[model samples]
Target: MTTDRTNWAGSFSYDARRVHAPRSEDELREIVAASTRVRALGSRHSFSQVANTDGDLVSLADLPRTVSVDAAGSTVTVAAGMRYGEVCRELHEHGFAMHNLGSLPHISMAGAVATATHGSGDGNASLASAVSALEMVTADGELVTVDRDADAERFGGMVVALGALGIVVRMTLDVVPTFEVRQDVYEGLALDTFEKNADEIFAGAYSVSLFTDFVAPTMTAWLKSRVDDVDPAGPDPDWMGARRAASAHHPVPGMSAESCTGQLGVPGPWYDRLPHFRLDFTPSNGAELQSEYLVPRAAAADALRALHGIGEHIAPVLQICELRTVAADEQWLSPAYRQDVVAFHFTWVRDAAAVMPVLKLMEQQLAPYYARPHWGKLFTHEPGHLRSLFPRLSDFRALRHELDPRGTFGNAFVDQHIG
Candidate 1:
């Protein structure tokens, strides 16, 4: 099929000559080998041009949506095009679940893995960490399979490749027994109190998120705690100086809470509670731009202070800013690689012209903390500076060249930021 397409946020219009959806692996391979320039498109959730290409944009939507659970091995293999919500339901029905999930369940499995997307938790690693093995179609139309146990070195460089490698077809992810979770939203959390008890606040739940406009006197906190792991009575009335919301809340202020998951400390299935938004509803502000920076946990306090200092400048184009934590992982290109990190995510009003300057200022202010930008979000950092932030960047580039010798997957986004 052929048509002009824009990303989910409508921030970018793909410039691909054609869009192709293959019905089978054989057809996908043929399209990959014949195209001069190509990139895999998944869910179109990204705000950046990472998935853009001048030749052809290949969508795996037509591929069979298959999920096979290896009960004995405690793993589930799924098609790359399948969304997390779709896979999570199947796993829950079979008495299994993934270790973690991002804020939106509508994101495609392969896309989330490729970008090292994550949820908020002190112990939980990025989504890519759960992947034990994956299958991809390389530039030469050759199918390649790599597993963490057998191809440790190469697998580390491939998981968060920013689509500089190849088109992933299937992935085998680790699974655990299904469990229940309860979510609570607290309002009026002062910046001073949060700074003093950040650790204690985040430790209060399995996953914690803070939302703010930066200039506000207080921020909103969303806490998701496992039913079996935490207190049965639920969170306290006065949680670190913040009071529980009397009703459900959307992350963005004044918006209807209709799209949000069950709140008010009600117990529900893990798949329903983990993600902030329900699968059937649009996630976050419908028209928005996002940018996130992950700084080492050690620099959390300092990073928050720096951003607060520039609140006046950022408040104009901002919709809401979220702060979450991510544990360290071994993936070479992951933003949280090798260190526990606190991510400051911005959901900005969709005005690229005004937001770009603020983003550049953020990178400058947080440079001392060695902040790394999320691969799929909008960022203004130069390749040289970003290379310095990631110690294994050179190794990843070498792996990219080896797998895609002709740079079939390379685009302006990859060439400018990764090459």
Candidate 2:
């Protein structure tokens, strides 16, 4: 079974009969045609079941590097499997850069764009917002290129397609003139300080992130400011590895664990800053589970307060709550598709039986705010509940029908969410 399945989140696993690596679209088509079922995998950064398959596992690792910079157009074309770090490096070499990047550098350009994955920025849209155009292979193996003003609905819906409509083969992303950012961390603030300074906090730089463990009466926040405009304090040696290093002990904040987060901050070069986190997973101290929710930006303070109000019950089993922000985009399935959002992440000590009660309680607390769960992260938002979260759910399902009527790219995950 280990050979038949792939691991996710150290708790969940799924199986695929055989794995295939295709170097080009022709090779990919051949694989798809031969398999009874197929799924595209990026760097396997997602904790969800979207990429799991029993028929065939297709890796675009062999696809030719397709990064291209068009200075006049201020855009870049990239292969589906191009890693985040590689994209930033290639673009920086051309004198342009992405507005923000997730904590991990190894994520695939097409995979991140496909899921509408994003970097944290109050004014910044998710990475998929950068698409000017791109290519996708439909279930029937038809290659289609889409952009704004051309198949706008399909393009918007496909931005976070979850591998339901087709496998993304290539993409064109919008870029801005390269910019620099600075990072700093602070300790022991009541969660409310963030609320009062939310706008100013986010606006001070192009991107920002806040980290806190709900167990304490206070919270710590990380501030990264755009280099050209704002000056940041020099890194405190104490906090450098404190946040990202794997916990040497169990579920302890700032402990020596493996790198749970992928990467963070603006390291020296543009490529260096692309990773969402710098920490690697230390050896397993224990099992773990994670869940995240996106709330209306205006209600961020209330959300944090609600979590803090129940801190005692939540903290013992809690690892940390990562707070991030994003601007609204047009992508139909994006958590912040048409609404600015505040994302809350929870890493729980793995105790499923005991944890389910708390997860349910938190879900109830977040209900009035109409929180949306991240598609790739863990959460209890079933299809019926999830249907109410996205305003464009119907439109997305319709677009999927048009492109893959036979459900060639679909799996159980798509069925649960879109059906």
Candidate 3:
């Protein structure tokens, strides 16, 4: 096993025996067919061992990066290893953009989609919702292509397959005409105001994100509005009892804004404004631990209150906490499946020993809401409870077994939770 390899966060070392970077799909197919077991490693952004394997790990970094845009079809096909930043820039040049992007654009498209990583907006769904087609090397080392139209029966399960089925190589995502967005930030919004008008506040812009410490009931709200849809000049100095910031601010308190995207109502390309961080720099306090739970929107008030009760204790090891909304989707294992959700995301100090107890307490508080943890983040949810949350768990297992009956692409993480 490689002792020198680690994830981006530098918190965990991979147990992979060897990592292969193939320059071509032909080579990838060969590696997959010859190996006893394998798993694809993208940017290694996940905090968990979701991407790790006891056997060989396949890396697509060496493959020739390709982006093919089908303007007429409203789709753009890209090498699965490409990051959202890379794809977005090229697409913007060609007058197109994806529906939404996560907080960091550096995440690989394949990894983000597989884990149901989502962006915030009352109307926007998770990133996987844009997947209409994909190509992957299955367990048998055969090339298989599937799309929504042709594979209606199984497409929902494919988009968020959790790296259990195969090593995806290329993905075709839905796109729209390029647009401009302006971001504005407001601070000290009262907890009561937010709870009473959560829906309206979220729907007030193209996208909205609220950041807090929980040590206090107040939080900051970031509103990103499409230029064509809202005033380019932006909100008043005092918006909803929160003062608009006069300068750019990083989501994490006390950090430099150099790495963050432009704010303060600056008009920029959708690709630039949709993500919280810029492509050139590392995202939010580089050394950090993350955990998120997506609970039904109806549970927002009580959920917030639960965390508020212990806010003082949470503020110590916490870097920051964020609240965002996601529209329901059909992805089989997505946290937001079939119900609109308010995602409570936590960026914690890197000490896992200090974070675990607090994390479990937070989970217990939200358990009554049936909160579903993000697949790629740190969580202690047991196998059965997790399986009960996703109605299509059995179907996803059937699909995975059909593609990899021998568990060629499976890992301990997938087996523990899925089996």
lDDT of each: 0.90, 0.71, 0.89
lDDT of 2 by residue, 1-419 (tens): 11324443556656777777787789887777666577887766566677876667777877888788899999888897888777787788889988778866667777777777877878888888888787877665667877876876467887788877767788888898986655545455555656676666555445666667875555555556565665354444344223322212222455642443312343354444333354233233226777788898998888877876667777778877777888999899898988999888877787767666887778888888888887776666667667788889888888878777777777788778887
lDDT of 2 at 383: 70
Worst 10 residues of 2 by lDDT: 240-249
How would you encode candidate 3's per-residue C-alpha lDDT over 54-159 as one tens digit per residue?
8989888778789999999999999998999999999999999999999999999999999999999988999999999999999878999998999999998998
Estimate the TM-score for candidate 1. Answer: 0.98
Q: How high is each candidate's TM-score?
A: 0.98, 0.87, 0.97
Question: What order do candidates take by lDDT, descending?
Answer: 1, 3, 2
lDDT tens digits by residue: candidate 1, 1-419: 32439888988889998899999999999999998799999988898888988888998888999999999999999998899999999999999999889999999999999998999999999999999998999998999998999997688898888878889999999999999999999999998888888888778789999998988888899999999987887778888888998999999899888988899999999999999989988664369999999999878878989987788889999999999999999899999899999999999999999999999999888998999999889999876677899899889888988888899999998887778
Q: In model 1, which regions exceed 4 Å deviation?
A: 1-4, 282-285
Order of quality (TM-score): 1, 3, 2
Residue pairs in collision within model 3: none
By summed lDDT, which 10 consecutive residues of candidate 3 come out lowest?
1-10
